[model samples]
Target: MNILMALSQLEVTGAEVYATQVGNTLAQRGHKVFYVSDTLNSPHQGQYFKLRFNKRSLPRRVWHVFYLIYLIFRYKIQLVHAHSRASGWSAYVACRLTNTPMITTVHGRQPVHRSRKKFHALGYHAVAVCENIARQIVRDLGVAESQVSVLRNGVDSQVFKPLAANHGAKPVIQIIGRLTGPKGQLVYQLLEQCIDLAANQVQVISGSQIDPIFDKFKTKVKFCGYSANIRQTISQADLVIGAGRVAMEALMCQKPVFAVGEANAIGLISVDNLASAMASNFGDVADGGKTELDIDYPQLAKQLRSALKQPKVDEEVYQIITEQYSLEKMTQRLLELYQSAYVYTKKREIPIIMYHRVIHNDPSQHGVYGTYVTLERLEQHFQTIQRMGLSPITFQQLDEIGLDHRFDHGKRYIILTFDDGFKDNYDLLLPLLKKYQFKAMIYAVTGTDHNRWDVEHPSKPDQRFELMSPQQLRDIDRSGYVEIGGHTVNHPKLASLSHAEQQHEIAYNKAQLESLLERPLYSFAYPYGDHNEQTKRLAKQAGYTYTVATDSGPVALHEDLQQIRRIVMFPSTTKFGLWRKIKGNYTIKKAAKPQTKNLS
Candidate 1:
């Protein structure tokens, strides 16, 4: 497949390096690849588009967009991969013009602003380099979790391999990265402090040709500007201190990494701190001050002293880089993502069948017959779904397959979600689910013993239906076919509650359910399908991978997971009606607002 890679700039930043590595690798794999950037110093062999976007005005950007279209047409580019935000915008327009698939890899710690919505508008699949950025995209930027993938940056282990530990009278400690921005001051301070050490013992590798900040400590440390042989420089150092790609490279070199950059000190990289280090990309994107390092110098000094004494890299640390942080793994994952980007790029209209109470005697006697489906009708719905070749998938499965884009289009997916955790769901729904070999997700109201939230329903007042007991929830959860989710503690109107109250209701219910089942809960259903912006934020803060609402119609691939749309089923509904909804062609009248309370 022909691919176009666009980067905002060709600077020696981690993002640029990542794009170069992946683009070159794709070319080597016999794919027609084109690399374009604002400034290109080193060129790749296959193809190059030396388009500069730096400080570009509106007209220039528009022209660049047209140029991108020309390139896409000339090369038959099937996919466009953008690296930085500016390039993302241009590529987004180009892809739209050419009707090609596009993917973005976010490398910087971008602030969550209103502009992030453009990613959705442009139909750009997002790839976050770290978990923190992924969470930010979902919670702060309002991107759906299913629309983003967390694929961390990787290092070329073959090029950046372990060298024997440097054990000499004076340890050579090095810091590598572009010495500008907020980190320059910290680098200056580090160099000044290291003046007491012999000049040969301290080394700095960066892209800045000449800076006043480093001029003061020129004689104290060897300041090499933009060396092509960075791996050799890093290999010679006894200890390497940096962040992001540099830290990963140091770890691959089997040199102990201090991971101090961007004003945050992540301390020594070891097995114990590996998870946290990897989460923030080793302090490259830490939560700290705007201008200078937020590190405690005295403590850093102590750690540095200890690090200098113990320059030997831990075997586990070496293994972590070799196994998980290799360039091959990252390239393969990107290749898979690039090839499968089309699976979820467009929305899929899959009906999420909503159920509350599946009872035996529910022909017409039930006060709330809308939510009350007879066992026979339930069987018929399942049979229709099965006969139609639709697979009933749990929310977890949908997330895994859709976000990862690892499913085939031959089989369609439908979600069976039961809200309010009725006892009949366990007694009646469980057997049919097991017998029909279908999977369903049940959202429980943890605080209430009965369906009191529905007591004040306009049609059915003072209803006292028993909710599933904790043990019953545990039972169905143990069954491999059923997954448990949260539906707020008291089932109150989340939009009406204060943010704190909403958080407690949503998060507390999740905590209680997880405690009861002894497993993590990732899906949540808003009570009564009532939620505001605060409700969505709290659901994410509560740690739900996705949430569902009572909104009508089939769920889409790009629909917010926090408000997954569902098709409410009534007793009067038939197999044909179900088929229409599943086919994304039906529009049933929404059930009464208050009816949502009692049904759950």
Candidate 2:
């Protein structure tokens, strides 16, 4: 699968780091990844495009949308993952225009306003870094709870794990963050009140430039600007002070962390407050209704003093980080989300109604495997479909629509399919189809005119039915109401046959049908809806654009075109049952039921 990762930033951020790590993991797993961002700070394993996503000009935003659409089509991108609001806005519009699927990761708290609520571009799904951010997204942006997932930032334990302990006279305390905005203010406040300069050595690891206010403490505090190897700097520290991913990495290294962030302040992360600290992303996010950091200078000072003195290593912290916050675990979760979002965005919910034999007599007396529906019941089914304003379409038409990407969300369509090419389909079903001006596809077995397979079977030898003859199939093909498809020369379970046998059965029957009708067939049906991967490949090799099964397939229609799912219509089916089956949730509901034989 091709995936695009979009980020709107001028400098390296936690979101950028997260996206790069996940993208590299996906690339290693054979997925093609592409990056589009204002700047690339981390080493990415895929192609990168430089775009000014952080710029808010109207023309630049429109250009972003167009370029994204081009990338989606040119690369055949299956999904897009936007990491910030500025990029997500353009990505959302591009995805909507191209009918592509996208998801957004909300890395931090967003400002609440009317425009933010109304124009929130959180795509088909939103991933929040923590529970607090998830709640804020739902409450502030009006995104549904079901669409929001709370996934914390992952830490690479291999690089950040505990090294030899630093046993020094005075403990080394490190503060790691960008010295701007709320983080800069927090740094200043900590230096002025929380840190006891006489007892512990302080190191500030940030950018190259330093604020003038920090000059007063320059003599006492070490300003180590922008170390490329953060793990080395972290290894030298006895206690790390930061928030979000920094706190997680510190815990992975088996070092104590003083968690403070833009939103709030967590004095020290311990087993007692670990859950709360994780929920708020180590104090990078506030609880509901709180906008600023809740700080107590004297209390924080006391906690810091105690932590510096003890500097105890908690094994539980390391265990939790290794188990729940590992890079591999996070990458797997992200892959699941990408596939789900892709299905949600690209799937068409048109229900395909399956029938085997339409008889005039009472079906219960002769029905086996629920394959028969009475003529009266069939008419009633057609009436229900017409009353519900659903347009009946053939598999050929469906293929054309899918190829053109012209599915309209406002219109509803249902596929009426008849298996086995029974004589009753032409004798009893054609008149009703003509009366209603509906289209149907019938799968025909070209080698025989009778149900020899079923009649010869030991299970139910008494059950036998005549098949449509070659002339009858030709007449139906010319009727413009029904299309003919292949169902093999004999109705044998394809899965039971060898690969060569399956190939001969599928390809020979398709050839016979095309020769008889002087036209190509577009669809095929597996006998008994029984097939394996080899049989599916044979069907594709036979030139059928679509092949269908009874019930075993992916829920999304486009996910597995070779094994399209169909809803079996029983003799006892009512209008209400048909109505329920035609809805989008029927496949999901039926999946929960126990598996049964696919007699159709």
Candidate 3:
């Protein structure tokens, strides 16, 4: 999959660093990653485009939107992950214009206002870096809770693992951040009041130029400007002071962190206060009334004095980071979110459930193929669908509504398709459809009025069942609740036949079904779900707007109209199993198991 990481930053901030790390990890896993931002300081594996996404000028914002559109088409980007509000706005516009899917990661608290609430550009789904930001997004930005997820910043444990303890006479203290923001002021305050300059060796790792006011403490503090190897620099420190990703990386290295941020101060992280610290993203965000400017320097001095006295590594800190913030785990979750967002934006992956027969009594005598569900179970399934608020739609309805407007009616839809046009469908299923006010698509075999093909098969020679006659098919076709589709002349596997034979079976069946129903068939179902590329081509040539196969096809329905996938409703399938199969990622989970025969 091709992914674009979009950001708007003047310098390397935590958001930028996080995107870089995620992009590199995704690239290593064989996904093509592209980046667009104002500045990219970290090493990346994908192509980078330097765009001034930080600029909010009218013309610049317009240009960013158009440029992003071009990049998306140029790279065939499957998804876009915007990391900042400015970039998200432009990226969201571009994605809409191109019909592409995008997700935004809210790395920090956003400025909330009436306009922001009215037009929140957080993309199709929003990923918050911490729980505090997730709440803020849902509450202030007017984003739905269902669309927000809290995924904390992940650290590369392999590189940030604990190193040899610094065993010097003086404990080393490191302050990491850009030197022009609240962090820079915090550094100056710590040097002047919180830290005993004579007792500890201090180093400042910053990308910005050192402030001239720090020249007085020049002899006491060592200025190490912008080390690319942060892990190596962190290795020499007994105590690390910073917030957000900085605090996370430090904790991953088993070093105690004095967590202070642009929002508030969370004094020296310990297992006792770990939950509170994490809730505020280690003080990078404001979780309560206190702000960074409201810091009590005298009280902070006492905490610092105590921290320097006994700076020890905490095993629980490392364990938490390892379990909750591992790079691999974050990448996996992001991938799942990307697929879901893509399906949602495209709105083409409607669940098409396949059912063979609905029997009135026990199927123990003729359930060899596991294809029959009891009438009671069928009613239960319908009740579940109604309770879930899923609209049972036919292919005719879908065509009329159009793919883009599938979800516009404020209810999700699923296609209930019954194969083989069984007599039970006309007698047993039509009333349920009327009772539930639901619609279904039934595939009819034009050549026979009974299951002659299955009866003739050596494997199931005695499993004969009655198929709906032409009159029954016409009645259902005009019932306003069922759409009739062709299912070949004799229900033979098309893949095992010659090209001419396949065309005869597919085309002749369509002609026969049209003659009976007096309406053109819009869909075709491959018998036994057995179809190759040739069979799909034949079905298209026969003039089917859509075709379905069992258990094999792309997850996104629009990707291949001729071979759309369907979930088979087996006899033993429970309500939970039905729910799982109806989900968008069911194909992904199904593919992991061994291939099974298509009982249909």
Candidate 4:
């Protein structure tokens, strides 16, 4: 297929380099490639279009409508891989004219919100960076699961070789990026990794005082000039660390590179394939039943840092994560994205979905803390959300979605959150969340005796699927969207527990959840809406930044991510009932029902 790459501008950036990199890779694969964009204003551009089709005065949407038609006819393009939402929608319009396929990659999940849903409806399939993104795309835009591909961009081992450390210099880490604007702030990790974490262990190299992001970390790390000759710098480094194109480049240079990312953010790199991950000890793959390439969650960077202390384990983990995302892997994945970009499909864009339970429907349970929403209702809910414009948003998106970024628009956006990990939650929930491209955050008990109300002896396995097992929870946690929030282990009445026990219940549960998820648990929800000032205090002590309560109202008003309230619609909440809550009206608006206990 003749592929046409589209972006607002071919500027020198990670995404741009990636597009250029992939274009270079694909070009070598013997495919006819063309480029179209706003301007060829990039660090490196051999040949591409001037894209002088300026649409000023016209509304952005209207310009896209007009450009969509022009690009289709101009290039006779069979496929369009839009780098930005602006380009993506325009590609959508072109797809209409030329019957081309269009695809969009949610690069930053930034607040572009350019409305990719139009492309989804018009033969557009979204290529998410990771599983979290796969689910997020579905949740955010009601996109069909099959159409949305979680195509993680891979690193090229051949090109980005592992670093050959000679043991002369302190360990070095390279963070290549601009130190200004939106992308600039990412280098702050240098402080956490270079200065703080590497205090006495390693030297950190990152964007410097030339950009504002360098001001804090100047004393800690060597300010490496922001340039493309990263190969030279990474070649002389002990550890090539960072995510995105940087990691790939480091790996291609044969340097052991560690990718620091949450379960969802760096969705592109996969630790599953050890052979292809960072080639440990200069391309020697780790060989052990317990693979060394494995890096657990919660403190992902911390885990890597600790592993770095253990060369054997550190090297293995590096090899796997690196190899998995090697340029070869990324190439295949990109090819798939490129293929999908031009291949028209009547698919759904992903959206955010909200879920209540994953178990059987119990009559006694109302909304909120009860297993009121059964698998049937849950499935109906997914179907209903699908019918509407809503799709599933990855739970991982929650991590990036603060003041910095927001949900995608135009397509639907759904937030799928499971209140109680009822036995059915795993049974009824997991498959569905996986099915509908939904990322669901499950709030389960971190304390012992934490579980669904074992209805009829619970009929659960040795481990309650209702409340996930450490391994299961960790697996879901690792999945990026299956966020594990504190539900009070042992289901204690927070108000009743003393400060010590309350602290233990909250903090201990978080630690336990962290153990399972392999990442520090950040969000929590009180049990039975029974948290008190003490409970809230304990929650904070336990490292929880956000806490959810049974605020029986739809989330219409702006919500505080931390201390945010929830309006649950359980089995008692019929579809009509939910409609009321979603409309900013309480479903059962009965004088703001009192908490089961004074959970305020």
Candidate 5:
């Protein structure tokens, strides 16, 4: 499938970066994904094309009209997927002339100026990143039920890991994103709300902007510039306060996040909820008719005051991030979405989830896999998605899902992939997937040394495990239910290996897996789910087309193809867990608040 993705701007933003990630992943999956950005010199792009679109010109449409046609011929694009409104309008024109399937993934609300309703009808399909936005596109924008679909923004759960959340005896809260533009004032808003709550218990931390306004709250506000250590910074927070998607990022760190309404990028906050959050009296009390309001500073203070009298840990949020929003589960959904899009004919991003070991009795083994989720919990996870009308698929069928097909069908779909075929995965988890009849990809690690460690024969002395045997792998592959990819012979960090060593690990494992499954194999999984410049070059040199990484963020078009990220779903989730995760309602509760710190 040939796909040409269009980007209106190249600023370091969520939308641009996300588009690149989607495009690259599509290319890796054997779909010819081409990216055309407003700026020709986009740092994150592949096979770039120049699309002449100047908003200033009266007949800016004139340049767009011709360029759209030109791009059709240039890329032989069967479909055009535009990221932003301006680009969507241009792509709509091209779709009209070329009669090609053009879709504008309506990431957010339609711009106030453009005749978005009309432009939306011009395209074959539309995608909204969140349910609130999707409902708005359908209700307010008047896009047809058939034309509009919900494809929420996803994150690679692993890349964004939970760090030590302790504050060295002082409470800390992390605020993310740039302080310029709409995000700048959020610090002040947060500070306003936290003033009484943070008086002495919390040290507010912002990773970027340092503004004079924050000086007023100097004792409580912390301004740290562009923290490279996201996990560490987020870990210290007793609470995570952020704007827009940063709220979700804070959630990924397993911290409870309270977002000021102005910071919510997707506009999911209902005006009423903001009013409730703003209501000063209730301190984290559950009003019977109204949902429990959790952000009231007085209520929070009461809770903190109560907590101070008891025993509590600082790393509490870490547990939630791993359980509900990990890269493993996220990637599982991503793979499902990709495969669904392959067959459905719409443009969207999907992540392939990666999980390490599943646990039995040994606490050490359980630690390696993080908290082990019970099988009953797994059943609830699958049941939640099933009830929601999302069809879970396996990784092998991903190749069969046609990208040109997702639109015409009313049903939305996704693929579930589990990386690093661990013993517990085969024993406990595979049964559930089989019960559900879902498909997934398993990147097997093969080699002389790898085969020696048997998972079934765990030694009492911290029993190290073994990779699945070639015969067992063949049995799994023969079922036609799973796709076997290489996970290198040894599970060392790919970035640490020499180029030649990396090639051998990748190439040799590919051949070994191919012989076991007797199938064409080309996909590669980074060992430790880690990849660097050297590792990526080695994968290409070794002939694998698709590679997955641990970077925690949603897949987008402009992202580098080989360096993709996924979510790691863990055991901490409850019955309502998968629902909130899938329906994109993680931070909808505390959608609005105020912040005092700024991070530039």
Candidate 6:
């Protein structure tokens, strides 16, 4: 596939490094990778376009957009991937002009209020470098939860290979980035205060932009001007301290990294701190407070001096780099995003049936109306699904359909899901399901023997619904018609919990259910369909393959599997109401453009 990469500048920054690495990798894989940047210094082998983006004038920026359009037509660019904000605007315009798909990888925490609507209007999906940036885009930028994804910055392990043991007597500490930046200041302070303890010699390699601070540090450290080859410099270092791309590269080189980025300082990168370190983009853009930095010069120096003697986990660090932060993994996800980009712009109509209870509906037992469905009404709902010539598939099956695009044009697809895992699902719902020879997914609350979570509801304080027993869950598992998925153990509001609590709620329940069923569990349903990005991520990290949210809509091909959309089938919903949902007649404010491309 022919692709165009757009960035405002090819400056010596983390974002530029990421674009260069990804572009080069794609080119090597036989993709026709073209690049357009304000600066033409990227080391990647690509057909480059000279597009100056620094001009603040509107006419100049407009000219660049038109030039991008011309390049799109000239090179038959299938997709435009923008790396920076300026290029995002220009590429967005170009994509709109050509009706081509576009996506942007947000490199940092950018203040995006005025352009938020413009970003939505472009209908371009976003890639966040880390989870913090992902949240920033969703909450601060107002991008839809479905429209943003996290693709962490990756390094080429092959290019930045580990060297032989070089932790010699004289500890050589290296710092690489612009000297005027926060990284430079941090490095300066560290060496100035802790020089007697931390290092025998300190090396500072910075870009062409000279800072006056370099003169002040001349006596204390070596200020080597930027070299075209950075990995080589990293290879010679005993210890490396830098932010963002430099730290990742150092880790790939099997060197211990003291990660300090523009925003925060991550003291050390190790197995215990890996998750938090990466969340902050290795301290590059740590909007979330996850790092512990002893910025006190004397204490930092003492700590570094002590740490120098400790053995390094080079292999463990290398394993992490190859597994989670490799170029290949990043490229593969990017390809998937490119292929699925059309889903965001196009409306996909499908039906997802939501159920709470299949017992007899009594008016007095339910203060909240949607929680109970009569047995007869559920039977009618199943009959309607069958009569409408729709196929009932599990959540896993739904994901597979999206992946393979195996749709029957003559017949529609309907997803049947049961929440709370009530006792009636085993006693009443299973037989009807067997009668129809249909399959469904049941999200069980593993910690409880009953639906005690609802007792605290403001409106319905006395609703004490009984949940299915452990044996019943196993029974449903034994039956081929049901897929048992995870609902939280306590069914707490996931968003209200801390990250650690959220992880325990999700991962612990998955473990409990898998043990009970004696099988690998993949599907999950959020309790009350209430979850934030953190909750969804916890579910993914817990090894769930797909998750359903209570939001009313059809699942889009590009939607995050961790937060799949589902339309609720309440007790009050009639056959006609189900049909309208099946027909996608309900109003959802986010409208999609008419689809010109077919998934099937």
Give the winner by TM-score: 2
Q: Provide the TM-score for each candidate, comma-separated.
A: 0.57, 0.64, 0.63, 0.44, 0.45, 0.57
lDDT of each: 0.75, 0.83, 0.84, 0.53, 0.55, 0.75
Q: Residue by residue across 372-412, what tens digits does model 3's lDDT show? A: 88888888888888877788998888887655344332448
lDDT of 2 by residue, 357-399 (tens): 8888764436455578889999999999999889998888887
Instruction: Write candidate 5's Cα lDDT for 1-600 as tens digits.
Output: 567778776343446545665665555555677777676432343577766554737488678767878877876776777777777777777777776766666554454335655556436556655455555666666766655555544445655655444555554545565555445664565457533544445444433446676677666555566554556667666665454445556555545555453313211122234333212111121222222222445443344334333223234343533443343443334444333333233233443445555555455555443535566666777787678777665434444564333322344555455666655666766677788876667778775433233333355323455456667778776665666777888666667778788778888888878877877775677866677778888787777665677643224311344665555567776657556544522322212211211100
Model 4 steric clash total: 92
- Which residue pairs collide, candidate 3? none
Distance from true position, residue 535, model 1, in Å?
Answer: 40
What are the clashing pairs of model 6? none
Candidate 5 global CA lDDT score? 0.55
Tens-digit lDDT track of model 6 for 1-600: 577888876456677778888989877766678888877565987888878877748999889888988998888787788888778877888788787778888887766568565555324678888888887767766777777888878788778787655756787778777666456667667656765633466788876465676576677678787768898787677778777778787787777887767666666678787777887788767664332333666766666666566537556767876677788888877876665563343233456667878776667656454577888888888888898888888766666555423232243577788998999899998999899999998999988787777776676665677889999999987898898999988998898899999899899999999999999887888888889989878888889888888872234634467877777777778998777777643423343442322111
Per-residue lDDT tens digits for candidate 1, residues 387-504, read 8888899978877665433233255678899889988898899999999999999999988888886776677575577888999999999998899999988999999989889989
Ranked candidates, highest TM-score first: 2, 3, 6, 1, 5, 4
Clashes of each: 1, 0, 0, 92, 86, 0
At residue 160, what lDDT does model 2 achieve?
Answer: 78
Better candidate number, 3 or 4, judged by TM-score? 3
lDDT of 2: 0.83
Off by over 4 Å in 3: 288-292, 349-600
3 against 6, candidate with superior TM-score: 3
